[model samples]
Structure formats: structure tokens, C-alpha cells
Target: MFRSSRGLYSHIPCPVLPRCRLPHCLFNHGQQHQTKQPRQAVPQRQISNSASTAGSSVYAGKGRVSSSLLIGQSEINEHVSLAFKGSAKRDAPATESTVPSATPTKRARQQVSVPLESKRSADAAANFTAAEDEAKDSAVVYILPVKPHPPALHSQRLQLATALAKALRDNKLSTTPNNAASTKELEIASRTTSATYANTMKQHIISLGKRGKSVEKINAKKTNEIPSERILEYIPQLVHKEWQLEENKYLTALPSQNEIEEARAAVASGYETCDRCTRHFKVGAEGQSECVHHWGKPYRVKGSDKKFSCCGEMEGMTAGCRTSPRHVFRITHYPRLAVMIPFRQATATGNNFPSAVALDCEMGYTTLGSELIRLTILEFPSNNVLYDSLVKPIGEVIDLNTQYSGVTSVEDPGIPTFDATMNTVLAKYIGAQTILIGHGLENDLAVMRLYHKKVIDTSILFPLDNPGLTSRGYKRSLKSLAFSMLQRDIQGTSRSSTVTRSTTEGVISNEGASCASTLPPSVVAPDALKLEGHDSIEDAKAAADLVALRVKFMLALEDQKRAGATTELKIAT
Candidate 1:
């Protein structure tokens, strides 16, 4: 065994001997040689590189040994003796051989000779060991430093922190004694303030009630139950038979004339000329002048040139007249008579029929009880008057309900009969597909003897708080709804005198001759006269306005939904 500088041992195979085969003797000699001469270790760096070089040199010497074996015994013995001599020299010291020689030729000549097979095995072993050393030296490994992380908090500490935060939040929300006191004071003040306002409004309404005589008349007429026999006496006499026939002919004519043109023709006829002004006041003309004393007031002198005795003057005041003279009628009055004018029946076609129309009807006491006296229809949004007429009931008139109806007399000329309005105006313009909008429309339709299915009633749309209440309380009033939802006032009057006069006449006719002396005096506050009779045009338009507002809000909501849906779709994409 020979120790290398890398602390590794290299073992030599059996040494060659003569044909006598004395292995024990050879072993003893190898031991004696190793004891006599110790080998020095080789350096680790030189050991790996020199290992293969030394093995090749030994293989070269072994190739010559086989040729020597083919020689005679004398030659073989001579070769064995030479080998022994070389072994002696080679075994002298490993240190001397490990030192690199200056001359490569001298190093080759100094190599030890041994058996061919043994040298070959030793050379192969050395080459393998050298390869292993080279592989180990060429390998590489890397190590990286680790970083330390913060330690986790204990469960108890975390719970403590959470509780502390919660306690602090609670402390902040808890009201102080001063704050509590202040909140209570504010609530009390608000209640007191609200109560004051409510009381004020109630007193104001009561005061208005005393001043407006028309309001009392309206209420009385609505509540009073008149006998059917007595109602017939109020009906006007059919004195103008010829005129009625001619009016009917114009109404029943085919290819009906335009309503506006027909109205012009009626004014030109001069049949309904005002007695005082002698100016023709068409039945439906707004703000027309007429004698206020047409019913023969005691204050007016009874003569061909009838004059006002109340003012103690014959000439009439143009601006304000309280006598027999032409006077511009109220807006309410104009629409009332305007509805009486008849137009030839023309069937509503495509665009001729309005998309939506709001309707309202006024009923008067007649032999048939309550009867439809006036009907007003207005187109939605545009608010155009589609059809407006005073419809004479099938039965005789009893009370004109002039307080609310604004109809002064049944004898007013140029007014179309109920049959004519129903056949010519209502039937022609209103169809099954038309959307009829109104407030409390059922009553109006029932009075007119009309059965329209597509109706939007504001009363139904905006129901009262307790809808399950009695019939009278089940629906909200149109005036209340208009004021609340639309922030508008309708069916209100600033001048109570005109309303009182109209109402007094209606009451007098309704009650017969004896009740005139008992009638209430004409007195009303300008601002307080807002809660009175129904105006057809005003009520119809109010209903339409409500529907329009609802539709506008609905469209806005639909647009918002559509916009949100579009945004979501885009986000999804």
C-alpha cells in the first residue's frame, strides 16, 4: 500500500516472480522493502493530474513484458533479474519519484518494471480514481441567508386590543346629559310649532266658509234632495221650434263643418243676440258681453230701454256693470256656453283622435234626478279643448246648479241638446281606443250614459290614506291631490261676488219662489274663496296634468334602469 498526498491509499497488485511460484517469499520481500524505505505523500493538486500520466507510462513498460515471455528460460530469467533490480530502485523512496524531474526523458527511464497484466490492472484502477477526484472537484453548491419574520401576537393580547377599540367607540356614541336635554327640547318645540300651524289653517278655513255664499249654495245643492215633479217646472219652454229644427239639420249634416266655422255661422245667424248690446254672443264664445239683468231684476226699470236703478244711472259703466248691459263673462262662463255650440259629427281618424283626453261632467237636478248638463274634454299635455258642450238632459231641468255649473239659464240660445252632443261630438271624437283621463270619472261617465273602458281616474290613481273606508272617504278629492302632488290650486275663485250671484240664482230656482228671502248674503274673503264648486275645464286639465307628471317620472326611472343595465353589460364584457 502507498499513501498519496490526498490521504488516499493506492494498493499495488502481486509482484511477478520466476516459474518456481514462491508467493510467500515474494510477500516477505515486499514487506521488508516497504519497512526499509517509506514513501512520502504526494500533494493533492499534483496527485490528480499526474495519476493518468503515470498509468500510461506503466502500460507502455508492460507491453514489452509479453514479448519477453515468448523468449527462452535464459532470456526470461535475465528479464526477471532486471525487474528485481528495477523494483529495488523503484522501492527506494516514493518522495523521489513524486518530485517532478527537469527532463521528461530521465523520468521515463526511471519507471519500475512489473508483470504485464498486473501493471495493466493497476493503471486502470488509477485512471478510475483520478476521474472520481476530478468529478468531485468540479461540482458546485450555493447557500442563501434566510430573513427573520415578526412574531405573531398572542390570542389574549389581540382580544384585549379589540375590546379596547369597541369600548372607545361606545363612549363616543353615548350621549351626554346635556345632549339628551337638548334633543328633548327640540322635539317639544317642533310639536308645538306644528300644532300652531294646523290650528291657524283650520281657523282660516272656517272664516272663509262664512264669507263665501257660493260655497254654501254648492254644499246645499249637493246635499238637498229635490222631488222629481218639482224639477220639471225649471225646464225651459220649447218656444223656438223652427230654430231647433234648423240647428238639428246643421248638426246631422254629413261631412261636418269645422267646429270653428260652425261657431262663426251661429254668431252670424243673430238668433241669440244680447238684448242690451244687440251684439251676437255665440253660445261658446269666451268673455262675451251680455245683460246681467236678463232675468228682470227689481233694480232695473221695466221698459224698452231697460236701465239700472241701483246705481241711479241709465248709461252703463264699461269696466264694471251691475245692470242690463253687455259684460265680459268669467272664464268659467265662456267655456260653459261654448260647450253648447254644435258641430257636424265627424268620425275621429288616425291623428284626429287625441292620444289621451281628460273629461269632466257637471250634473244638474232635473226630473230624472241628477243629469249630465255639461261635458268638457281636453287633450293631454297640449291642453287643447277637444269637445266642450252643455248637454241638455233627456228630462226636464230642475236646478241649473249654476253655483258649480256656471250655467245661468236653460233658455240660453244656440245650445245643443243632449242627443245632439252624444251623437255628434262624443260618438264622433271618442273611440274605444282613446285613453280617457279624469278624476272621479265613474260618476261623470255614469251621468253621461257612456261606457268607456280605458279610463285613468286620478281619484283611483291617488287613493286616500284609508282606502278601505266608506265610499265617500275611499278616494282623495281632486283639489287636495292637485295641491299636494302638483303644487297647484284649481277650482278656486278670488272674487266671491260673482260666484255668490250665480249660486243665489241657482238656489232660488232650486228652492222655488219662497226661498229667495232666506238666501245668504253675498260675502267672501278673496283668499278664502278657494274651496268651492267644480269647474269642468279646470278639473279635466288637472287630471291630465297629474297623469303627465306621473308619466314623466316613470320615464325617468325607466331611463335610469336602462342606463344602469347598459353600464353593467359593458362592465361584464
Candidate 2:
């Protein structure tokens, strides 16, 4: 975008030539034409012994095309001489010469010498030649002789002054006159008075002479005068000013102001100011605005009266620039964050690996059974916290659940609403082809209000291979699976007996599981006790981790089915 204007500046001061603006010459008339053709071979003749003549001995031979020789006049003559040898006859020479004595270099003429008949006639011819030579010698050199320059006297000087004045008025002078100054001022700037200007005029005359203009000779009286150097200085500035004037006229000849403004508006809508200006543009936004130096050149003013110079720098501004958005405040991870992310559709096609992490969210109700709060996204494979946004419930916490899904009401800290939190966290995931992994992925997908068909539910993958496991697997919570395979335990929620008085008063689980869906008391986790409340991020992570734990061993046993599951672990490690 940073373009150089040196070439443009160089051309700005050039003299305007009318013919230079005309269309360029396209065809080269002097170029020659050429053609190519395939070569053809001429057949050779043969002599037969059976067709012998009466007096000559018979000889026969077959002739073929000779590749060694070129066909030309000499070869044709040789062939003719050989073919008519027997019928050839000699003839006596006639008085008239058959061949000329000398051949002309050009085809138009040849020389034939004839002997002179008598000395008298030759002498008479010689006398006529001598008289012609003498006459040519006596004739004056009638050359288109070059004449010397006329004297630089007053008469010649007056003629020059008149011609110069006429040429200047007609705008026919080679050099442009200064339009910025009056005639008297221009003459002063030229540093020559009428009395002493003849010396300055001489050099101009000499230059004009070289260009084929008629010039008078220099006189002895004018020989010692020196040409003024100030005239030389005035010449360049006048030419420059004249060129600027022409540019001003041309620019003024452009379209209407309304048209120019419309064009400017069109360009402005598509482009923006540089970063410095953008900071001033969006001063109170959530994310920091990123600014970059502008690549624009200095602005220029067109006319002498325009006043603006070509030295003022211009900067461009842009909006919504970020290195990374997610971890904007996470100073430790800031270096790895990518703010202006380009979203890509999840694709299972091509030779790409089929592994992906999954996340789930959980919400719980207040004591009054009125409002629901808390939302979290969990990263599978490692059960890492991707995002956990606490949401203030619409109602107050009354009865606390101490069993099953592990959640309570004390966690809210005046955080945003569930909708706001979800909008922020969910935006990080959910793309065209992302593969979500979980136990009952459909239910989790339903809770998150996100749908992706490329998910792999361990419940389905393992069940298809083990019928017994399938029938008994409903008992397998993510915690049970995690304990059995990965040897990691995740606690569920524990509710007091008073709070659990009526199973009808079902507290809100963000994923919304019914009392019927709860596991038996015998297998319920003792450590599933709620501190202040249950976290959605924790639950989502637990579920995703449970699937990932079982998936590890499941992948090992079935190589082709889940081989890609290990790709994520390798990258994370």
C-alpha cells in the first residue's frame, strides 16, 4: 500500500507536448514479411542401352536424385550440354557481336566496344571533349553555397525584437512565459534592460539558429558583451510555474463538486482511519482496540493558492482488531491467545484425524424452585476447565441438594444471567464439524442448545460391541466409568433429607435430569457433598472426562474405530 511518488513528481514539471498526448504508434511499417514451405524432390532421368544412335556406342544407366548437389543454372547447363552432344554444330562468327565485352553490375546495362574508323573523326571528338572540359572549368562554382550570418547591426536587431514580440504574443515561443508575473516584473526577473538585453538576445539567437531558425551575423561592436546569468535562472522558474498553471486548469476542468464528493463518500465507507484514530473512535468498548501505523503518503495541494504542502503525514485507522479475544485478560496465556479468529467448519472428510474434546453445562434451581443459575463448558480428555461462568439466579436458594448431581445455591456472586454467560462461553465452541463426546451426547447437546452430528458417545460405541455391557451400562455414570478405567473419581451432588422431602420439588439441574434418572443410594458418592453450590464447568468436565477415560481403553481394543482419539492426548502432552 506504501507507493512511491518519485516518478510522478519527476513528470510534473515536464513541458506539455501536444503530440505526446496522442495515442501511441502501433504498427511498424518497415518490417519485412517471411514464409515457409515444404521441400520437394525432382525426379532424375535414365538412359537405356537399347535406344542406341547409329554412329555412337550405346550406354544405359538409371539416374536418381542426388542429395549432394543443389539444383541451379550451372547444373541445368551441364544437363543440356550432355543431352544434345550428338546434334551440336559449330557456326562462323558474324560481324555483330553476340556477347557484350562487359556485364553491368545492375541488370539495366552492358558495355560493347566498337573500333574507331579514322583518326580525323577521333580527333574531332577529342576536340569537342576538350572544349566541353574547358567550358566546365571556366564556369563559377554554382554550389548552393552557405552564406555567413548577417551583421548584428541595429537593423537586424530590430527585426529580432519584432519577431520575438510576435512569437511571445502568439504563444509560439519554445519556452513558456511566466504567467504569475506582469511583463515589467518578468523583464526585471530576467535581469536585462532594453539597452543591455542585446547580449542576452545573442545566445537565444544562436540557439534558435541551431534549431533551423534564421539568425543574423554577430557584429564586432556586440562581440564583447556577456550574456546575463539571471536570464538562465528566470527560465526554469517560469517553465515550472507555467506547468503548474496548466495542471491547475486541467484539474479545474474535472467533473462537478457533487460528483467528487460522492466518489469520496464511496471510498470512505469502504476504508477506515488508522489505529490511532480507531482508538479515539471506539473509546469505551469491552475489548482493547488494536492500532497499526498507516501506510499512506503525505497529502498534497494542487495550486499556489491551495497552501497545503506535501509534507503532512496521514494515518489510517481500523476497528475491531485483536491478537486474541478469549484470553484477553488472562495475562499468562495472552501470548498464545488468538483474538481475530477465523471460524472453520468441522470437517470429517479428507485424511484428517477424527478426535475432538467435548463439553457440557449444568444449571440448578433456587430454594423457592423459581430461578436457575450457573453455566460451564468442560474440555474432555483431561477434564480441564474450558469456561465456567457463574450466573445469578432469578430466585433465592431455599433447599439445598446434597445428593445425586452435586449442586447448591451459595456459588452466585452477582454474576451475569445464564443467557449472557452462555452466549459468551458457547461461542468458543460449536462449529460446523466439531465432534462432541459424552455419555448421552444428545441430552448434553440438548441442554447446551447446540447440535452437532459428528459426536461419538462411548455408550453407543461400547454397547455395539458388548451386548451385556449395553444392558447393564445405564448404571454407569461418568463417575463410575472414570473410576473403573482412568481410576479418577468425580463426585455427584448430595442433598439433605429435609431438602429432599418431596421428590416432586425437583431442583433445577442445568442438564435437567429427573429424580427417576438418579442413581441408587448404595452407589451414590459420599464425597458428592456440595460446598457452596455445584459448578456447571465441574459437571461438564466430569462427564466429558468419564467418556474420555473409557474411550482410552475402548480405543486400544478397537484400533480402527477410535484410533484418532489418541491424537488430542498427544497434542496436549
RMSD (Cα, Å) for all candidates, in order, is 45.6, 43.7
- Per-residue lDDT tens digits for candidate 1, residues 1-573, read 332455222243335522223323323233443343222332332233333232232332223212221111232233433433343344433456445332334334344322322333333323323443222111111110001110111232223223322232222221121222222222222233433533433443344344333322333232223332222221112011232223212111222246545555654543454433445454333565534543212243456454553344444433224343232221111112233422222334565665567788887755433567777766655566656556657655645656566665555454567777677545545765566778876566556656445556666555444313422445577979889877767656421223222343322111111222333221111111122456566677778777665454434444555878999999999
Error of 1 at 161 (Å): 41
Question: Which residue window of length 10 is worst by lDDT in model 1?
Answer: 141-150
For 1-573, candidate 2 gives per-residue lDDT tens digits of 223444444334324332222122222212111222111210000111111221121111212112211111232223323332322212111233332122212221111101111121233223333443222111011100001111233343444544443343233232221110112122321355456556565555455444332111223233223222322222222112222323212111223456545544554432323222232322123454544322222343554222212223321233222232211111011111111111123323332322345555444323212233434444434344444443554434432332223444445344565465545544554444345555555444433334245555544433322223433443345546556644644443332121222244323222322222332221112222354333444445555554443333223233422445687668889
TM-score of each: 0.34, 0.26
Q: Give the Cα-based TM-score of candidate 2 against the true structure.
A: 0.26
lDDT of each: 0.42, 0.32
